[model samples]
Target: MLKRTISMTAAGAALVVAAVAGCGSNVQPIQVKLAAAEVLTQAARKTAQVTSYTVDAVVNVKHPQQGGGKMQGRMVYQSQPQLAADLTLDTVDMAGRSLPGGARAVLQGDTLYVKVSALQDLLGSSKPWIKVPLTEQGGSTEVRQLLDQIQRFDLGNMTQLVTASQDVKAVGTESVNGEDATHYSGTFPVDVAVQQLPADRQEQARKGLAEMEDVAFDIWVAADGLPRKLAMNGSKQGATLDATLLFKDFNKAVSIEAPPADQVGELPQSAPTN
Candidate 1:
């Protein structure tokens, strides 16, 4: 159930970003006032060409029924040669509760290693790591699902949020990670964003977000024409979401190792969902 909880949270964040597909706020717009999508699309293309990168991301979700929490972490991702990632969950608090000292996860090849407090009692051992073999699910690595549907909000996917905007504008200039970049901002109405979704997804989006508010988005692209940062915010009848991604070290080598075998345990038939 922990998997499903993380998935649900990720889905909530996705719905907000995809639902917002827009940007606007403190960052003022300049005279350029170009269509934001142009910049976003260019940035997306440049980023996609890279084989790997490091991302510092944070997502916050607030819901009346499901409650809310803050999830922030630094992750290294590799797309060339193979798919791999290593990340630490700095915080995973929900409804005023949280995991003990947070959690950490690593995905190398088809194996995933997760280190969290929940594993201690469930496995009836003191080993800090629990190992699980991953398999391809549909088009994504199961690791992505295991780690809060991470692929859904990666830089590549985050950039796609712009395509749903109908009035995005070049806001101004800003420095991201010390690089000067163009800032884009705009807002998309709730109904309009849903219309932009695939027919198969439109219905689901409508029903799931029937009470959601419009999302605002902001994108900063460096002079090199790559995204420096991306952010989105929105709210539903009982939930509010705010997410931001900062990208850097494109195509950098990332090293990750599994925990020592003796320090790890095989996942039991029933994993802790709470």
Candidate 2:
């Protein structure tokens, strides 16, 4: 059942990043925020490469009909770019009466190999867990997407999502988690669009574009041009998702390899048609 959830989660999760964060009023100032964002962009560019990342993600599952559940887990992701990554879900644990036990998935290239127990299988049996082929899914994955999104830091790209039209003012500098950091804030542009669809489908949209409105990020970039921390909060449909990411120990070689023969299960190379 957990495996099925992961599969289902993958689909819903595709737009999860869009669903988080909000823009608070006069929170900090425009210049402060823009500068912080610029700093983060510079840090990302300066970094030699990010081979792997350790993520402690706490996922809250909610449905209009069903209440909600929270699950948290630590993941070590290794990537070799166009290749595959050895993603390990460690300390896998979750709680929430309706949710299942821990979950795991081995995603190589475009294939997301999920394993679920028979009992859990019954939970999502009626729902679609897998997705269209990777070729069809387009360019969207935790690691891969960052490469493009980070470029938006040029203020031009950042403005498209947040208070871009308004002036960005920089607040005074302060210490965040022991690192000297700068703060910023601004008014959101009345019209800003956040990318919520898969890259390929993003161009074919209209209403309900993702709730990236009135949102701002507290980005912490190291003096050396590396992102050390980020805080984002936003609201939509009467719901809010706040996320914070702190990067450290950024010294592993980026590497991804095809799944070992033993780990590669029997999966059809193509999706079935009606």
Candidate 3:
């Protein structure tokens, strides 16, 4: 009789253990793509309603030949902010050549103020700041294009990217800048992403994405539904690009003003006689 009792107890214990294991295996992570997309959409709306805020970013670009370059900078954005940025490139190198001194750029309105220590000899009087008006008629096309790329570092664009992603899922939770955040991983197909944009923007977005194969992104969203950190990786032409952006101090007071006229110099005109 005691043997039978022992056998029964062992059976009960085994069943309990199996039940606990089943429960553990059933645990599921929250689906992030659609849900997080909705959350981020609302967050984007709220962000658009804000007057101003500050953005801090670290930009690293790698080339196929060398280790690439690094730039860290900050921007104070107000209203829609246009496509403007005020940042200092901490370190820059190209094809194993290190640029002398760091560079600073202030892009506000339609004007771009650039100061590069390496180009001082070529700039002559515009030693400190070269103020260039982005004009289609006769402007530095390269500089204008660079400024346009820089302007894309806005929250609105980031949110749009998130919503347009083909697959956005919660991978786990992490602390970003000391705040608890939910980490999401996803991918963006150029064609699919373009379809999500407004009609007015679809063509432009399509043209931009035509060069890339696809983009993989990871975003950390705080409890407030705002993205705290973003990482993107993509390849174009044979080179890969990795970018990281950190967001904080949302709705914070910020002031952005163009440099004084006296301190700014117009781009030198082409040699009088070609």
Q: Number of the top candidate by TM-score?
A: 1
Better of 2 and 3 by TM-score: 3
Whole-model lDDT, candidate 1? 0.60
Best by lDDT: 1
The alpha-carbon deviation from the true structure for residue 232 of candidate 1, after best TM-score superposition, in angstroms, is 0.8
Q: List the candidates' TM-scores in order.
A: 0.76, 0.54, 0.72
Off by over 4 Å in 3: 1-34, 62-69, 80-84, 150-153, 198-210, 271-274
Q: Candidates 1 and 2: which is better by TM-score?
A: 1
- Can you tell me which runs of candidate 1 are displaced by over 4 Å? 1-35, 136-144, 151-153, 189-213, 271-274
C-alpha root-mean-square deviation, candidate 2: 8.7
lDDT of 3 by residue, 133-214 (tens): 7754675555654544443323554466567775677788899989888888888876676566556555544433323568
Return the lDDT, model 3, position 20. 12
* Candidate 2 residue runs with Cα over 4 Å from true position: 1-7, 11-37, 40-52, 59-71, 74-99, 118-210, 254-264, 267-274
lDDT by residue (185-225, candidate 2, tens digit) is 54442243335223543332111123434654555554544
